[model samples]
Target: MTDQPQVSAEKPSEASADQAAPTPEAEAIAAYLLKHPEFFVEHEELLTTLRIPHQRGDTVSLVERQLKLLRDRNIEMRHRLSQLMDVARDNDRLFDKTRRLMLALIDASSLEEVVIAVEDSLRQEFQVPFVSLILFSEKPLPVGRWVSTEDAQKAIGGLISDEKIVCGVLREHELAFLYGAEQGEHVGSSAVVALTHQGLHGVLAIGSRDPQYYKSSVGTLFLSYIAEVLGRVLPRFTQSSRPVY
Candidate 1:
């Protein structure tokens, strides 16, 4: 009957107390609110009371935040619309110039005249600084900048592929051959359109002084269309049984 050991009840550790405390179920509450968005509509008062941190280190009501987001999206949409309008105006001007050039080519009677028309239109109308025409034929056309097939292959053999248009900065040798020593030195960018039609093959090269004037990613639809017109019409002037040197 003796001395029984007195048992003392120990207090829980700090870690155990923290773990046992009832924590706010923030994630669960958020999920519930997302699932039932109508809950906000029913409790309209919460919209005015709910505070959201703004990008500028200030708190705003949920309704104010929503308005700010809408305003930002509206501004972005207007900027995009303005860019689209600018592009449309540029396309319209280009189309008009292309039409005039095509008409001029159609009116020309000889290969030399066609060459003059092209150079004049591109320089005076299209504002291109430099232009060159290279024909791949046994006999050369009586035109300035017209190079023989052998000469073209020797200078830019790799560049002359099927009938695709090439645009961007050109190599030093290519620039020299296309624009000559003095002018080529100043040319920073160029576009070369391949010509292939009715046993004829050639290239139409255009150059500009600005390095960024022609880029690899620039559209070549108009250049290709102009080349096609040249191809079809050039044969008409060079259909002689004997070569026109």
Candidate 2:
């Protein structure tokens, strides 16, 4: 048979030399993810792409190492989130508990009850182990002295002693809070705040086991609140506690 004349066909235009070409490795990586985005993303893909045989122990070792690192980071993130959740829950409980107890403290019927309430509240609020409350009065007569401290009744029965600590308080409202002042028998580092209204006046003492618990420039909102409650409650106690003439 006679050979037919070859038909000439125009060649398609080629891309400019300056144009960049996508590498086969990049295309392979994209296809691997597109086919199995989740299951193939981790260490196993490293071996699969490299076409490492099952007999190659070195490839398996490297894959295990990378997987362990990812697992550790995931565990650390979960642990940190758990700790933050616990802290949020604890703070919520504390604010609610403190607000309730403080309200109960304000309703105390007597000075002793007030002190007990204050001590309990402080222990719960601030996490202190121990607490005490003292009231100082220049009532023209020593009040809350023998009555509060029965053991000191015999010693104080002799009117007044030169060694008594009352001299410092009535020395004037000069000292607001005494942290660790030497006060003979009543000797604990205490938060001494004043409470006064017209004719009836006194200082309130709040003490704890730790010496550093109370400081000089500490804000007195809670202390002042207790003092105000005491002013209201003391009147009722005084009328009921007065000796029959």
Candidate 3:
């Protein structure tokens, strides 16, 4: 007689064990904590006892790590505040200097005084080393550098065409034309502005020894403002004395 096939009790028990395996301890804890963040608030003692691994192979209490993060953020915020304060101070000084220069221009009576006002303020008050104010005319004037319209067009045509401030390093010939050959060679970077109002007046340029100093429009606001004042003031004198094309 064939006996009934006997079922293996071990196989059934093993399958049951595999199916009933619990979630990994660490994963279960993390998931539970994520779902109920208030768990930490209820068990405040864990904050002092929980260890967080540090980069240096040691561990620190969660509370200590939190304090360190707060300290780092405080330092970063302080640095930003300091930078903003520095910029504010600089702008205040610039505004004062600009106010003085505008007053001087208003007080100027003759074309000579006007030229002196521009040159002296830019050199002494503004602390600019290289400055050039070239007037465009059909004939050369006695005061300041005056170039025939043709010569100016040939030299700084690109610079004078734009009403905006032109900044960055300039071509050798352009530099030579604005400043003298010797001085132009020393100008590493410059900002040029075309003096224009009802008509084109001239060009005003300032140069620095540092190549990166005038690389953009960052600091050319004062220069452009000064140029506008000059454009209005200059026409008053030029139209009376020399004709400008």
Superposition TM-score, candidate 3 onto the true structure: 0.76
- For candidate 2, what is the TM-score? 0.37
**What is the per-residue lDDT of model 2 for residues 44-140, given as tens digits with 9 covering 90 to 100?**
4354335322344644453564556667777999999999999788767666655665577567655566556666677777564433343433232
- lDDT tens readout by residue for model 3, 1-245: 99999986655666686775566996799899899977866765555556665454365545665566667778999999999999999888988898888888878888898889999999998899999989877765779988766778899899888688989999999999999999999999999998888777788999999899997688788777888888888887777323234
The 0-to-1 C-alpha lDDT of every candidate, in the order given, reads 0.77, 0.47, 0.83
Report the Cα lDDT for residue 221, model 2: 46
lDDT of model number 2: 0.47
Candidate 1 per-residue C-alpha lDDT over 1-245 given as tens digits, one digit per residue, 9 for 90 to 100: 99999999999888898775444797689888899967865765455556666565465546675666667778999999999999999889989989988998998888888888888888898887898876666665566455566677788876675567788999999988878888899998998877767544578889888889888838667888899998888777665312212
Error of 3 at 58 (Å): 8.3
Report the Cα lDDT for candidate 3.
0.83
